[model samples]
Each structure stands twice: as C-alpha cells, then as structure tokens.
Target: MAEIAVLGAQGQLGRQFLAVLGRRARGLGRAELDLGDADAIERTLRRLRPQVVINAAAFNDVDGAELRRQQALAVNAEGPAELARLARTLGYRLVHFSTDYVFGGDRLRRPRRESDAPAPVNFYGYSKLLGEEAVLGAGAAALVVRVAHLYGGPSWSAGRANLVERFLARARAGQPLVITRGQTLNPTSVRDLVPAVLALLRRRSAGLYHLTGSGPCAAAEFAREACRHAGLCAKIQWISRDPRPARRARYTPLANQRWSQEGLPPMPHWRSSLAEYLLSAQNLPIRD
Candidate 1:
C-alpha cells in the first residue's frame, strides 16, 4: 500500500477518499493537519512524505461565500495553491479536485471542456477558480479532476444537502420536494469518483479531466430518481433555476471527450451510481 496523505480527512468528500483508501493511508483532519499553517503542511508532507496527496478541501458554500469572500478565498483558493506548491517542492504527486462552478453558464448548449473559458458568477466560483489556477500554475505532477453534484460521504452530509440526502429526507418526512428544473449537471457519486481518482494517480495522467457522471439531468429529474430509489413517495415540486436568488451556471454541463482521449472508461450513469449510493447510505452502521 503506497502511503497516501489526505488533507481535510474529516470532511464529507475527504472522508469518501479515506473510505476508498482505507487504513493503508494516513488520514489527517483539520485538527491534525491545518491548511492555514503552510509551514506545518510542508513540514509534515516532507517528514512523513506520502507519495501522493489528495486535496479534497474547499470553501464551497455558495451563498455564504458571497457574504464571506476572504474566508472562501483563503480555503478554496489559497489553501490548495499552497498545498500544490508544497507538493511540487516535496516531490509528492498532487491530485486536486475542482468544481463545475468555474464556468459561468452563458452557453448552456456547449458542454464546458477542460479548455473552456472560466467566468465565475459568484465568490465561491471565483475562489474555486482561483484554486484551480493556483494548482495548475504550481506545475507539479498533478491531476485536476473536475466534478459536479457530488454525493456519498463518510458522514451523512446533512448540512450540504446533496441530491440523494435531500430527497431521502424529504420523502421520509413526507415533505414536498421542490428542485430546480432549470439548472443542470451530471451527478457524480463518490463511489465511482474515489476509484477513478485513485486510478488516475496510478496512471500519472497529469492534466484537467472532466470526470462527471455519464450524462446530465435537471435537479427535478434527479430528485424524482432519488425518490424512486429510496422507496419514498413525495410530490416532487419542480421549479426553475431563476427563482433561486443565487446566480448559478445556467447550463454549464461538462463534456467528457477528454476521458476518451485519455482512454479511461466512461463513468457509470448517474442513476446507477445513485442506486449504489442510496443502498450504502441505508446500510450504514448506526452512529452514536
């Protein structure tokens, strides 16, 4: 087992990485490894020095990011930049996860590619975009995997309210579930994601890759599928993306031709991934 160091190991997405990597990897949460402390991050990376560092950390609250611009920039932008720089210096391969928000949704028809121009609509997007630039600029042996609509965490991730979790809770409570029929994304599940990320590191495929689920779907369609999978009967209320106060990418679905060019298999459809996600969530051991 190649020793891998995972920053933000306690976070929802970070924990998914831990689960996939298991006990073979050294998992460091914020307490154990602080991103704000560059010296600490570098010192630890150099001394314990894992072969690969997977950065799942990000300041991702879209609305909250608008209110706290500096905070978002620090974590989403500066932190990854610092880590990637340190990784290059210390000779550790870096696998950094970025987001779809990097692209502003002006051209919904044209699927955003690795080369598409990024025009972030909000502070969160801007910060994440900055992080992407930072990592790429570091010019380390890196694989920047961009994904969207993520679900499956070590924790239930109630606060984030990912598609499956939101729909399941609503159906369980018999609450009306209204989703944005206007906004679109290919839901990328953690199960499929973690494996692909690990595989990428092995291949040493260094560049930007659009690793989303097989295709795109509106939020409403995702909700309906979630309801069906979870065996819940809730009246799905459909709404447009415009009704939401936040400015989101209207239709910036990513194209996956890069995956083909790299000769990697297409990720399983969102529906298949979601079914597995729901099953695993249900079978989770009871937490204290």
Candidate 2:
C-alpha cells in the first residue's frame, strides 16, 4: 500500500497532489473510488490501508448546487462523513479540503479565523459547511483546511479551469474579459498549498485550519494582475455582482491564524504567487 492516497485525482487540486506526492502516493479518481458510495470507500481503503487519506473530491459548482441539491449533499456532506468514520476505525489520518464560502455573511470585510461562526449563503457553501462539521465532529484524526480562490493547477476538465487560467486564455486570444467586482478572496496557488499541506502532515497537525494565500483582492483586480504578469493587454469589463442564481458573500478573506500561531511558514502574498505561476514554464505557449 502507498503511504498516502488521494481521492479526486482528476480534479485540479487532486492532480497537484498526485504529481507532487509521486510514487509514494496512489491516486483514486471517481472511476476508482466514488465518495458517494460508502461501501466502496470502505472496501477500497481497507484494501489499500494507506497511512493518510486526502479527500479532494467535491461537487463545487456554487450555482449548480441550487438546482442539484441532492447531488451536492451526497458528495460534499454525506460522503465526507463516511470518510471520517473510516479514518477513525481504520486508524489513518484524513485531510479534507473546505472553502471560504462557509462564512458567507461576512460583509464587514474581516479576515475570518477558524473560530468564526460559519453562515453559508448558498447551497454549495451550506453543503460544504455540513461536511466540515461532520469531519471535525466525528472524533477522527483529521485536518479540515478551508481555502479560497484556488488557481495554478492542471485542469482536469475544460469547465474546471481556474481564474488565472481563464484570464490568461482570454487575454491571449485577444478577448475582452467580464469579471465580478465586489467579491474578495485570497487567490491561492495550488503549488503553494500543496507544500503547506505536506508540512501540516509532517507535523501531524489536525482539526480546522484556514490555509490560503497571505491576502485578498477583488476578483477583477486579480484578473488584471494576471494579465499584467503575462505581458498581455486586454479590455476588462467589471460588474457589481455575478449574474448567477447563487448568492455569494461580498467579503470572505480567510485568515491563517491557526497556521501562523503554530509557527508554520508564512504563505506568500497572492500577487507574488500569481506572478511566479504566470512566469513559470507551466504557463507557456504565449502568443504575441
């Protein structure tokens, strides 16, 4: 059995873990391991018997969740609860990913700490919040890391492309970009997040932690910065709100208070990580 097992291997973040963890880790995508299937999850894990299980799978469509509540709940809430149960019985550490959407009522623009009460505004956020509660309350060895605006990872599907990739593609194609304005988030880099997670595992850290880039910015501003770094000039139209049916919080910057207090390495500013990713070989084939 591999030392580590990563579920959701086909996802952007999951792919990063598979790539970074290399041979020591085994990846199980939806085809290999379905989170919604409790028996399958238990049977598979019992066979692998990995020392650590990292759950990266989730029904992440914020607006889509409004229409498909059951699908979202099954994958995001119920599935995680089962994983937590197995982690305790099987005696393996579990690392689960969560989101900033859990604190939807934060209109005051304060950086939310782990201790802050969660008030999800949309079904997607609500489902994830449920998952967080289930995992943490299960009395299992688990790490629930809440992140925001993840970028700089391999997109498993065309629709899964992150903010940085979307902006870069549009800019390279000489297309004007339309971005939301009021929503603020810490645009985290998968590259940076992967290492921080590894550090937490090395230290055997558990419980809830907000793991995101150092600071936050408006979505429009983040797009502009991405274009600037790529030496691309593109017209950007900003809108006050997203036209989607789902309600989104205007300000939800997650503060890495627990991570910092634990003496973990400080996460780089969002801009610094963005620049590094845009300039790196991962983002190549620049036209013009």
Candidate 3:
C-alpha cells in the first residue's frame, strides 16, 4: 500500500480524499501542516516521510484574493513550490489541485484543454497558475489537476456553501433567489471527482489534467436542476453578471479530453452527479 498524506484535510475535497484513501492515508490540516510556513512544511514532511503527498490545500477566496494578493501568492504559489521541492528531495510523488479560473473565458476556447494557454482573469486564478508553474518547474513527479464549481461530499466544507447548498437554503425558506445568468460552468461534485483522481494517481499519470462535470450550463440552469433534485419549489430570479464586486470569467468550462484519451473512465454529467449528491446528503450514516 502506498503511504498517502493529504494536506488541507478539513476541506471538502480533502475530506473526500481521506475517505477514499481510508487507513492508507494520513490527513494534515493547517494545525498540522501550515502551507505558508516553509520550514514547518519541510519538517513535517521529513517526519512523516509519506510516499505520496496530495496538496489539497489552497487559498480559494477568488474575490478576497484581489485584496490579499500577497496572502494568496504565499499559500497558493510559494506553498506548492516548496512542496514540489520537498517531494523531489524525498523521492515522493506530488499531486496538486488547481482551479479552472486559470483560463480567460473571453478567449475563443469554449472548453479548455490541458494544453491550452492560461490567461487568468482574476488574482486568485493567477496565483493558482503560479503554483502550477512552480510545481512543474521543480521537475518532480507531479500531477496538477484543475477543477471548477466544486460541491458536495463531506458536510464540513471549510465554511463554504456550494451552489446546491445556496439554492436549497433559499428554497427551504420559500424565499426568492437570484442567480447569475450568461455565466456558464460545469458544476462538479467532489464525490465524482475523488475516485477519478485516485485512479489517475494509481496509474501514475503525470502533467496537467482538467477534471469537471461532462457538460456546461448557465448558473441558472444549475440552480434549476438542483431545485428539481431537492424537490424545492422556489421562485428563481435571473440577473446579469454586471455590477459584481469581483470580475469573474464568463464561460470557463474544463474539458477532460486528455484524461479520456488516456483510456480512463469518463466523469458523470452534472445533473447525474448533483442528483447523487442530494441523495447522499439525505442518507447519512446513523451511529448509536
């Protein structure tokens, strides 16, 4: 069994990584391994000596990154660089997660491929792109997986409410909801993502991969689908993307063509995955 260590274990994706890895994995959150601290990360990795280090930790505040550029670069860029260096020295495989925001949606590309040039529209995306560069530059055995519009999996998701949660919350209260229109993305669930990621690791795949739901849809479409699965009859209002505090890319959907060509299994469509997530939430395990 490969010795696996997951950073940011408290996050939605991290928790699912832990659940998937089971006893073969050790999870380290900020308290155990702070990505911002270089010496601390090196020391902990030395002590643990994990054969595979999965960097699920990230400063994922897209809007906040604009204000905290230095903070974002520290955790999102420098942190992954350090991890890559350590992985090289320790002879371990490094798996890092990035975001689909790296691509500028205004470009002609509809669904971004692994080989597409990255032109981030926001500070957060730029930081993650830097992290990818840092990790790849270190020349270690690494895989940089980029994902988008992530939701579902563990209930404890670092205090971030996903699209489904936001829609369901308003629907349950019978309140009117306003969702952005014109903006399109593939809303992905962590449950569908985790197993695919594991398989990639098992196959020792290297380089970058874009993993998300199969199809793209507007944010309003995603909300309506969630409503259908959750059985919520709530009025929804669609609004233009203008007048937002932060500038978001318009149509940044990721394509898994490279992964597919590699003969790996395809990810389920957005609606199917969303339905599974809603069902899973209702069937939590009971403990005596």
Best by TM-score: 2
Tell me the tens digit of each residue's lDDT in model 2 across 110-152.
8999999999999999999999999999999999999998987
Off by more than 4 A, model 2: 156-159
What TM-score should be assigned to candidate 3?
Answer: 0.93
1 or 3, greater by lDDT: 3
Candidate 3: where is the Cα deviation over 4 Å?
Answer: 107-109, 155-158, 281-288
Q: TM-scores, in order shown?
A: 0.91, 0.96, 0.93
Order the candidates by TM-score, highest first: 2, 3, 1
Candidates 2 and 3, the one with greater lDDT: 2
| Candidate 3 displacement at residue 261 in angstroms | 1.3
Question: Using lDDT as the measure, what is the rank order of every candidate, best first?
Answer: 2, 3, 1
Give candidate 1 regions above 4 Å deviation: 157-160, 241-245, 281-288
User: What is the per-residue lDDT of model 3 for residues 53-133, given as tens digits with 9 covering 90 to 100?
Assistant: 999999988889999999999999999999999989998999999998898766574888888889998899999999999
